[model samples]
Target: MSIPTTAFLALALQSQAAAPAPAVAPGTIAVEVAEDASAFDRLFTDAVTRALSDARFVPLPLESHSRYIARVTVTRTESGAVTAKAKEPPAMAALGQVFVPLPSGKSQIRGLVSTDLSVDILLRGGDTPVWSGRASTVQVEGSAADAPAAVATKLASALMRQFPRRDPVSVP
Candidate 1:
């Protein structure tokens, strides 16, 4: 059965600066991924490199030594038999559904996964990250071919929207 379903694209972004730091001036940045990166990770890195380039930062080849390095990691967490509770409509908020504890949901939804992306920018020899950001989203898991490209591209673009600029906000 072909089900026409929309991909959930609610992305949450959190970024922080390492102490009082200097603004990142446009310069060459080397993108690095885990040595044994999976297909999804490779695709995500490529997309992020493009995003960095679009932001006026030159992305150097992975092997090339550069003053700045953009180390990124991507992870997907999946769970079987998910239970999602329905939220009351805005008009029903005054009826106390929003405040009162709702009963357990009876239906079990499957195949949903949470994808997380984290990027850390650091100096060549620095042990601590000079800047960092994380983005996360949940969507139905697609086949190998479609998921990596679609999800990686969209996630990379969204995460890079605040590169090097958004002042660090304390995340609890």
Candidate 2:
């Protein structure tokens, strides 16, 4: 190539390398928290949707444009960690059922109820994932009634720690 063309190409390549990667703009996302009872509870879809909205991810109807898409799955389980070793008469069964005791003689049980949540952000009509994250938490079973909302709040907050985008990508 001529000297001028070579220099111009070199500068262009340098700038391209130095430029920061593009990120998903703060815009609407067609979020779908499936009501998959077999995978989790029925309330998870609503909880996740609400949490994403609270995090400022505009929840657009599924019929919107070629924007972003967010799919999340949340689960809460009776980890059965803190059960009593001897099944004789269930001493402190309430606490035992809620908190799994340590396997050591001092306490031999599981630890606590565990909640796990995961999220996937994808570009519309694409098989590749733009961003994804997973978070888990353990809490006493006393709040079982509110566990749905509580876990949702925690998972959503954790996923949104980076918010909008967990990783950067160049838009087409």
Candidate 3:
């Protein structure tokens, strides 16, 4: 899926900021799966679950036995006003240009709201997170594809950079 370039940058930033992982095996994790009530929801859930599994933490079923619990999910939200790009001339283009309107009036593109995708991973339900990351940019409303899975993959990779930790202590 085509995501904003900034999303990849977020992946890098998160990798550096997160504490190192603990000495956990690939199959010792218990994943808290989200309920799928609709096709879209199912897609998102499946993507998240699949990505988590790909990270090789060995996610256990909700009722299965595991040492720790993890919750993975992605959310999209829009906010803030759009701004003009640099290097563009003024709204009038020229200082002496009369800002006259046509019979139908002229329309100029202004700032657009930002669309951000937040990917989070929680272990044992606490204020601190086992993994977390987000990717955001001024995505055109209809120009982007609905690919929660791709976003999850990026988030997972970033979080798993230090997988199978060499240290026994979990970084805070």
What would the TM-scores of all predictions be? 0.64, 0.56, 0.44
Residue range 38-142, candidate 2, lDDT tens digits: 434545555666666777677787778837787766666776655535433333424745954443444345456777777777888876667676677776565
- Report the poorest 10 consecutive residues by lDDT, candidate 3: 163-172
Estimate every model's Cα lDDT from 0 to 1: 0.70, 0.63, 0.48
lDDT of 3 by residue, 89-159 (tens): 34543347657432434334443434333344444445555555444444423332224444434434444
In model 3, what are the clashing residue pairs, if there are any?
A: 26-57, 82-111, 82-112, 83-111
**What lDDT score goes with residue 152 in model 2?**
64
- The Cα error of candidate 1 at residue 125, in Å, is 2.0
Candidate 2 residue runs with Cα over 4 Å from true position: 1-22, 35-42, 77-80, 83-111, 142-146, 164-172
| Segments in model 3 whose C-alpha atoms lie over 4 Å from true places | 1-25, 36-38, 80-138, 145-172
Candidate 2 least-lDDT 10 residues: 163-172
Question: Worst lDDT window (10 residues) for model 1?
Answer: 6-15
> Which model is ahead, 2 or 3, in terms of lDDT?
2
Best by lDDT: 1
Ranking by lDDT: 1, 2, 3
Model 2 backbone overlap count? 11
Provide the clashing-pair count of each candidate structure: 0, 11, 4
Better of 1 and 2 by TM-score: 1
